[model samples]
Target: MRSTLPTFNEVWQRQCRSSILSDEKQFFSKNTFLVACSGGMDSMLLLCLLHCLFPQRVRAMYVNHQLQPDNEVWATFVQNFCEWHNIPYLIKKVQVAKGNLEAQARHARFNAFQQTICSEEILVLAHHQQDQAETFLLRLFSGAGVNGLKAMQKIAVKENIKIWRPLLDVPREKIEQWIKQDSIPYVTDQTNFDEHYDRAWARHTLWNVIKPRFPKMQTAITRTALLMQDADEILYEVLQQDFKCCGNENSLDIQALNDLTPARRRQLLSWWLKTEYRPSLDTVDRLQNEVMYARTDAQAQFFVKPFWYVRYQGKIYRLTEQQKKPKQYEIEIFDCQNIVLNQKYGLNKDLLKESLMLYPRIGGERVHLHGRVGTWPLKKAIQEAQIFPWQRDQIQILKKEDVILGIITPQGFWLAQSDYCVPNGWLPKLDGVSV
Candidate 1:
C-alpha cells in the first residue's frame, strides 16, 4: 500500500523537462536548490519529493522569523527531518519588522535565501494549488485587477532568486494521500485555524461557498490564472511601447499619461505596481489614483514615511529626502558661522572667505601654475588641472591685486603659485573639526 518513490530520472524528466537545459543528460549547474521548508505539510511534501529525486542537490532552509513561540519548535522539526535523512539543512533566525506574520515570515525567508544563495543557485518553495486558490480568492476580495488575480506562477523569480512550485498542479488531497502512503510525517501550524486572521477564516469560508456553488471553481480559477499570464504578456508588451516613448518603470511621463484611456491607463499603472513595486496589488490604486491625482504641486508624495514627496513643474516628480534647496546664491564664505551643509558638496578650504579677485575663466585668462614652467590660459590650466564638477562651483581664483594667480578646480586640488596652497601637514583647525 506504500507509495513508491520515483527514480531520479523519472522525477527529473517529469518536472525539469521544461527547463532550459533541453538535454538532461548534459552538464547542469550543480548549485544547491535551496528549499524554504516551513515544517508544514506542503513544505514537508516538497522536501520529501526533492529528497526522493536528488537529496544531494537540495538544501532545506527553515527560517524562524521569531514571531510565534512555536517558531523554534518548527525549526527543530525541519532540522531533525534533515538530519535523519542525511540531507544538508540550515536553520536561520530573523526578526519581522512589520506587517502580518505570514507575509513578513515569507519575506524574511526569501530574503535569507537570496542573501545566502550564490548567483548560480535557485530557491524552491512549496506553494501548492490551495495556496494558489486562496491567493486568487483573496485577490478577488481585495478588488485586484488582472495581474493580482493571475495568482503565483509555477516558476517565478523576484530579484536574484528563482521560486519554483512543482506541486501547483498537484492538489492538497493528493499531497495528503502521498504523505500518508509514503509515511512522511508533517507538523501543522496551529495558527492556520485561527479565525482572527482573514486568511485563516477565508480558507474554510471561501472554499465552502465556491465548492458547493461552482463545484469546479478551483479548476476554472486555475484556467483563468493561465489566461491571465497570457494577458500579462500582452500587457507587458504594451507597457514596453508606452515606456519607450515616455520613460522607464519608475519614471512615468505625466503628459502622455493623461492621453491614455482611463481603463487602459489603470491597467498600465496596475502592471507597473504589481511588477516593479510590491508583489500584491496593495498600492495599485494609490499609485494610479490618489497619488496620481494628488498633484505634483499639491505637496503629496507616495512614500511619505520615508520623507519622499512628489513635485510637479508640469507633471509629477518624486522628491526624496524632504530636502529644500536653500536660495543658492554666491555664499560669501566671509560669514561667521561655518559652511553648514546638509549633504556633501564641493568645498575648497583654499578658496574660503578670501579677498581673491576671482573672475570666471575666459579664453584670454592666463595663470602660472606653481609646479609648471610658464603661464597658460586659466581655462587650459583648469582643463590640464583636472578640476571636478562639484569643485568647479567653489573654485578659488587667488589673484593678489586683480591678477589671476590660479584657480582651485577639483583637478587634484591645484595650487597655482607656491604661495597659493597651504603647506602640507599645516595644522589649521576650523570650528573644532580637523582640516
Candidate 2:
C-alpha cells in the first residue's frame, strides 16, 4: 500500500533538490517549508512533490485571488486533495482590487502569503524553465536591462519571506511528462491560451518560433543570467558600501554617485529604478533626465508617482507625497494579526501594543505633537505632518479604552500610530527625520 504522501515526497526529492529536504543534505537537518499551490497542474504537482519528499516539513497553501469563475471550485479541489492525504492546508482569500489585473492580483496574493511566512518557513514556487525562458523573452521584448533579461532567480526574498523556484532548471514539458507518467489529475486553465495577455501570447505562440531558432538558448540564458547575477552581486556590494541602504526607500548619495563612471552611475540608477521601485521605463527615462543628469539640488523634486521617490540634497528619498497632503479618519476596531505596513521614511512595527482598532478616513481625529503647541484634528495635523491624502486610513489607530495612536498611513509607516510622540532628543534618519 503505497501512501499518496510518500509518492509526492519522492517526486519532490527527485525533481527539486531542496536542501531543506532530508536526503539531499546528508549532514545538516532539513528546514521546513510551505508550498504555494494554485490547484493548477504545475502547483498541484508541486504540492504532491513536497508531500512526498518532506511531509512533516511541508504545508500546502492556496491563495484564492477571487479572479477566476472557478476560484471557489479550485479551492475546494485543493482542499479535498489536502484532506484526502491528511496534509495540512491553509486557504487564504484575497480581495484582489480590479485594475492592473495581473499586478494587483499578484501583489495581494504575495502579501497574504508573506503574512503567513515566519522565520522558520520557506516558500517554494513551481516555476519551471519554460517560465524562466518566457520571463527572459518578455523582459527582452519590454526592453529590460541586464537584470530583467536575467529574469527569474532561483531564490529571492520579500520582507521576511524566502521564495524558491527549484523547478527553474526543469522544463515545463518535463513536469507535464511526470504528471502523466504518475497518472496525476490536474486542472487546465483555459485562459492560458488567450492572447490578450502578453505572457500568454508569448507562451502559446512565440515560444515555438524562438526556441527552435536558438536551439541552445536555454543554456545561454542560464549562463548569461549567472554572469549577470554575479556582476549584479558585485554592483550590489558597491551599492551597499557606497549607498549604505536598500529597499524601495533609495537614498543615493549623489556625491558618491558622481565618483563612479557614467556607465556605472547609470547602472546603479537603473538598478534602483527596476529592482527597488519597479517603475515604468518611461518613469525611469524621465528620472534620468530630470534628476540624475544634472547637479543634485536640495529642492528639485522628481515626483515618482505611486512610489514616491524624490531626488533632493544629493540624496534619493522614497517617501510618498501623501506625507505632505492632508488626511481624515474615524475610529473603529477589529481583531487582527500582527502586521507592519510601511509608511514614509520609516517602517512601523504593527505589534499588538494593546489591542486591535480600526478606523476609516474621516473628518475628525486629533494628532498631538510633543514639541509643537496643542493637538489638532488628524486631517489638520497631517497637513502639519505632511501626510499624503492617498495614504490616509492606511494607518489603523489602535484604540483600547479611550486612547488613540496615530493612524496607519498607506506607505507602511505608523505615522504617530500612537500619537506623534517623538521621544526627546531622538533624531531619526532618512528624509523625514524629526530630530
Candidate 3:
C-alpha cells in the first residue's frame, strides 16, 4: 500500500518548522518576531502556531482601523486570547485616510506597523496561497507584466523593516483544516464576506467560478506566479546592469540609453521607475513613446504618481521640490584688486573703484559681453552658455545701474573686459601668485 499523505496539522507543523530554519531564521532567532494579529482566522492561526513553537520569541499586535462597528469587539477578543495564552500583545489605533478604502486601511495598518516595529524586529503576516492567487489574477486582469504578477513575496524589506509571510506557500483550506483540527477559535471579519472590497469580490465571486472549472486553479495560478517570479529575478539582473551603465542617483543618461533598442529602452525605463515608484503598465508605455523618443529640442515631462520626470540636455532627471530664489548682491570692484574674474579679468588699482550690482534674470535684460557686437538677451546668453532653466535664478549678472556689465557663474565668469580692463603691472592673485 502507498504511504498515506500527512495530515493538515502535521504538514503545517512541518512547513512552519521548515520556514523557521530558512536563511532568515537567523533574523528571527536574533530579533523579536512581531505578529500582525487582526483577530481573524488566518492571523489567529498563525499567532497560535508561533506561540506554540517559540513562545518567548514572539509578540502580537492588533491594529484597529475603526472601519466597522465590531472593531472594538475584535480588539477585545484578541486581547483576551493573548491574555489567556500569556502572550504579549499590543492594540494600536489608527485613523485611516479618506480615499480608496482598501488602500487607505492597508496604508494606515502598515504605517502603524512601521511606527511600532523597530529595525531589529521582524513582522510576521499570514498571507497564504489563495491570497497570492487572487493577487496574481487581479494583476493579470489589470494588464500587469511579470513583476506585478509575481505578487506578494514571502519575504520583503520595507522602510528598513523585514516582513516575513510564513504561510505564503500554504493553502487557505489547509490553514482552515489545521485550525479545525487543533480546535482553535478565531473571529470572522464581516467585511470579508460583504464583497465590497476587490479582494473579497475576487475570492467570493471570481474564485468560486474559476475553482470548480479547474479544481487545482489556486495551486496552478500560484505555480505560474512562481515562474513569473523567477523571470522577474532574471529581469532584475538585467536591470542592475542597465542601471549601472545608464543611471545615476537622480538622472539617466539618454546617449548611453539610445544605444539600446526600443524594447530595451522600455525595460530600462520600467526598471528605473521601479527603483522609486510603481508605475502602471500604461504609464510605462507612455513614458517610452512620448518622453524617450521626443525631439532633442522638445521639452517632455510626465508624472508617475508623486514624482515628476523631466527630459533636458540629453538626460532624464527626476524633479525635486527645491525652491530657487532670485538674489542680488553688490560687489565693489576696487575691493577685488587682487581677484581674478574668469581667469582673465584681473582687478587692478587702475580699474576705477566702482560698485557693481549683481542680479538674476529681470526681463528684457541684455548683455554685450566678451567682445560681442550686438546685445543679446541675458536669458539667451545663459541658454547658449548651456545653463539649465532651474539654475537661471542663481546666475549672477554683473551690472552698473540698469546697464549690463558681465555675468558671474560657478563654472566661469563672462565679464565685459574691454570696458573694465586692468591697468599694466597690476596682477590679481589669491596667495600672492600670478596666473
Candidate 4:
C-alpha cells in the first residue's frame, strides 16, 4: 500500500506546530517572521500557515520577478488576499535581466528580501523536500562535490539574515493537499510547467522518469543530503585545524601550506576564500596543481571576486586594487595659533604659514626619522614598520614650496631627510588615506 498524503492541517499539526510552539522555542520565540509570498502555491501555503500560527507577528512580501505575462495579475491577487486577511504586505518589483533567467530572478528576489528584512526578523521561504532533492540531483549530475550536494538547509543565514524553511521536510503533495483543502487562492506561473527551464526540465523529464522506477527516491536523496551536510561539517572542523597550523587570519604561509597534502591545501584555501570569493572546483584544482608548487620566484595571481589572490614572498596575500589618490593636495591654513589639525598632521605654526603640500607615495622618496642616522627609503621604512601592502601607497609626504618638510606613515610623523629641527608644542597629524 502506498503511503497516504496527509491533509494540510494534519501535516502542519504533525510536522510544524509542536516544534514551532515548543516551550524552548528555538525559532519562533522572539524574531519577527517575514513570509516571502510569490502568489504561488508553495509561498501562499507558507503565508497562510504562518499567519494562522502567529498572525500578529507575521508580515508578508510579494516579490514580482516580472518574468511571466500574468505576473501583475498574480501580484494583485496577493495584494487582495492580504487586504482581506488584514495582514501587512509589501510588494517589490524587480527587473529580470537576460542570461540565466532563473538565477538572475533568484538573485534579485533575495536581494529584495535582504534589503527589506529587519535585523530582528526571520525571512521565511517555502522550499520543500522535493526541491532539495532536485537541487541535490542537479548538482550531482553537474559534478558538484560535497558542498553542493549538501543542498539547502531548513535554517540558513543569508546576507546576515536568518532564513527559515518550515516546510523543508514537507513534500509537494502535502502542499498541494493543503492548498486544495483550504481553498487557498494561488496563481500558477506557466513558465514553471514549460519544461524549457532547467529546473522545470528536471521536474518534468528527470523526476518523472525516476519517480516510477524508484518510489522512495525523494526520501533516499534527502537522507543522502543530510549525510553530506554532516560530512561537510566535519570537513569544516578539519579545515579549521589546518588553518591554525598553516595560516593566519588574513594570509596563508606558503611554506607551512606546502607541508599539508594537496587535498588539504585545496580544502583550506577553498574554506578561506568561501567568504569573500567563491572559487570554483576547477580553480581550487588549479591552485593546488599549478600555483602551490610553482617556483618561489614565480609571481602568480588570480582574480578572486573583489580581490586578487597573489603569490609573493613566502606567503599568499589577498590584494585589492587601491584607487589612486591625488599626487598633491594644498591645505589652506587660517590663523596659525588656532589651526585645527588636532587629530591630523602636527606641524609648527611657521610651517603652517608657508605653502604646505601633501604628496602621496610616488616611489623613490626618502625620509629621516628623529634621532635616525642617514636618509631611509620610504618604501623600506614602511616595510620595516610592517604595514600591509595595500597601505603603502597611502603614506603622505608633507612639503613646503621647494623643500620637503615631513612625511606621515600610519605609524607616526617623521621629519624630512635634511631637516631635523625640533619645535615645541607643534605636531602635524596625518589622516593617512582618504583615497
| lDDT of the candidates, in the order given | 0.62, 0.64, 0.75, 0.74
Taking the candidates one at a time, how many backbone clashes does each contain? Answer: 4, 31, 0, 10
Model 4: worst 10 consecutive residues (lDDT sum)? 323-332
* Stretches of candidate 4 exceeding 4 Å from the true structure: 1-12, 19-24, 275-277, 288-291, 323-348, 356-367, 375-382, 387-404, 408-412, 417-420, 425-435
In the range 1-435, model 4's lDDT, one tens digit per residue, is 222222356767876667656621776588888999888999988888777777788889998887777888988998988887878899999887788788888888888988899888898889998999999998888887788899998788877888888877788998898789878878888788888887889988999899999999999999999999999999888888999998775678988888888788888888777764346888777765556667766656666566567665677776555421222334443223433443333355556556566676789977666557887887887787787555565567766665666666655566554442444425565444221
User: In terms of lDDT, which candidate is stronger, 1 or 2?
Assistant: 2
| The candidate that achieves the highest TM-score relative to the unseen native structure | 4
How displaced is residue 109 in candidate 1, in Å?
2.4
Stretches off by above 4 angstroms in model 3 are 1-12, 23-27, 275-277, 321-358, 362-385, 393-435
**For candidate 2, lDDT tens digit of each residue in 87-122?**
788999999887877778888998888888767777
lDDT of 2: 0.64
Clashing pairs in 1: 370-416, 386-411, 387-410, 387-411
Ranking by lDDT: 3, 4, 2, 1
Q: Score residue 197 of candidate 1 by CA lDDT.
A: 73
Instruction: Provide TM-scores for the models.
Output: 0.67, 0.66, 0.79, 0.83
lDDT of 1 at 432: 34
